[model samples]
Target: MLVVKHLSGEYEQRDPRTKAYATKVKDASLSFETFELSQIGRENNGRADALSRIASAETQSLTGSIYLTEAKMPSIEKRECLEIHQGTDWMTPLKNYLEKGILPMDRREALKIKYRASTYTIINGRMYRRSVSQPLLRCLNTEEQHQALEAVHEGICGEHLAGRSLAFKILRQGFFWPTLKADASEYAKKCVQCQLFATVPRQPPEEMTSVLSPISFAMWVVDIVGILPTSMKQAKYCIIAIDYMTKWVEARPLSAITEEAAKKLFLEHIIL
Candidate 1:
């Protein structure tokens, strides 16, 4: 019996002696190699599908649309700092002190706010504080002012800069607060990405203080030095202890470096 399998536009058969044409043979069971042909067809289909998927992925990557997501918006151009008028919740207290001449009953409290009369002024129905050269530091209750300052300093416009730079950027954007420098410094220090990539300073920020060991054995540095030429006792490793101020030195040799040997040396020579 013989059968034909067409693959890649070519006829295929296992036995070369088998005839090429199909014909009915009497009293003989005919079987086609359909299973092998099907297997080969499946393999070709799988390869084709994989190639198609790879092509689709490459096309999407080039077009930058591999997955659907929120449409990105363009960044706004840097603009002049905008000022907020009074009527904000944070400004209520200062507004009251300026418009009504109201003072708290406590003498200390009254004295504390006395500078407000001179420092603060009403402009276009809003309360503002006077400052030299820089924009007026608007008095806001606490949270809102911090939020506004942070939005400019560390939000979308921010590039996770250093403390001084962050504060200066905030100031240039016309926002002022009492602890602007400290706040910016703290925020930048806590930024996870900034900390991971922060550059170490060339010089120490503060002068280093010398450590003084008042007496011998007062301050000791201990380390393990090892793998020397083995002697008669088979002691090839050594533990060294040095005094910081007095320049005192002590060493113990061991055949094999072990915790028990090191502890025994410390207790016998150094401790006792």
Candidate 2:
């Protein structure tokens, strides 16, 4: 069911391998004037299901190894990206003082460096910061900071958390840089996906006072969902009618909504 929906583009493909397959399928389908995907049960799919079951069970019936090649690395790692060359950064001064007992010439600056470097330690040539709440946080350079923030904010497990939450998550993940909070705020604000699906603040944005309904249907509330992306049936708005007492909800879709349409929906779906 899901495979058919993904092929038809009714549902989004999120898995890397499945998304790749979907793209290839759509591209190959472009050659045909008409194309359709249908769900064929295993019973009607001939020996294909049997072959898959055999393959999954690791029962080799034939030499399919003729078509196989041992991959040296994963497919995800095959891409080329610019290598980040590590260099002098905010960590340079502190690292220098911590590792080599080096300090600036200025008396006040040298004392400052001495105090600051005391909170850090090097293990296996990597710097880590002392933390009271959790384990040592691994100090990051410019490149490491970018990589950590990217992976945490938009990686597989990421939920596109807000600024402070994003920073807190990174801290929990045991990474830190001087500008962590500021960078997290900036990154979350600029995230295209976050903006697209962001929640629309409902009316009565402030706290609501509870009202005592005299009866089950005595008090009611009405809300309109959107003038949103039109659906295939061309519905652009959703009207919801709710009874305050029983909390029963009746919702209906609308294309061109008017007071009359709202009235009819409430009468038919709710009152009836």
lDDT of each: 0.67, 0.85
Q: Candidate 2 — what's its lDDT? A: 0.85
Q: Which lDDT tens digits does candidate 2 get at residues 1-272?
A: 78899998889888988887777778889999999889988679887675555544543555665343446765434477899876689888888888888899999999988888888899999999997778999999888888887899889998889889999999999998879999999999999999999886778968899788999987889988999889999999999889989999888888977898789987887778
lDDT tens readout by residue for model 1, 16-57: 333322222211223543323233355457866665576446
Off by over 4 Å in 1: 1-92, 202-272
TM-score of each: 0.41, 0.44
In terms of lDDT, the poorest run of 10 residues in model 1 is 20-29
Candidate 2 Cα errors over 4 Å, as ranges: 1-87, 204-272
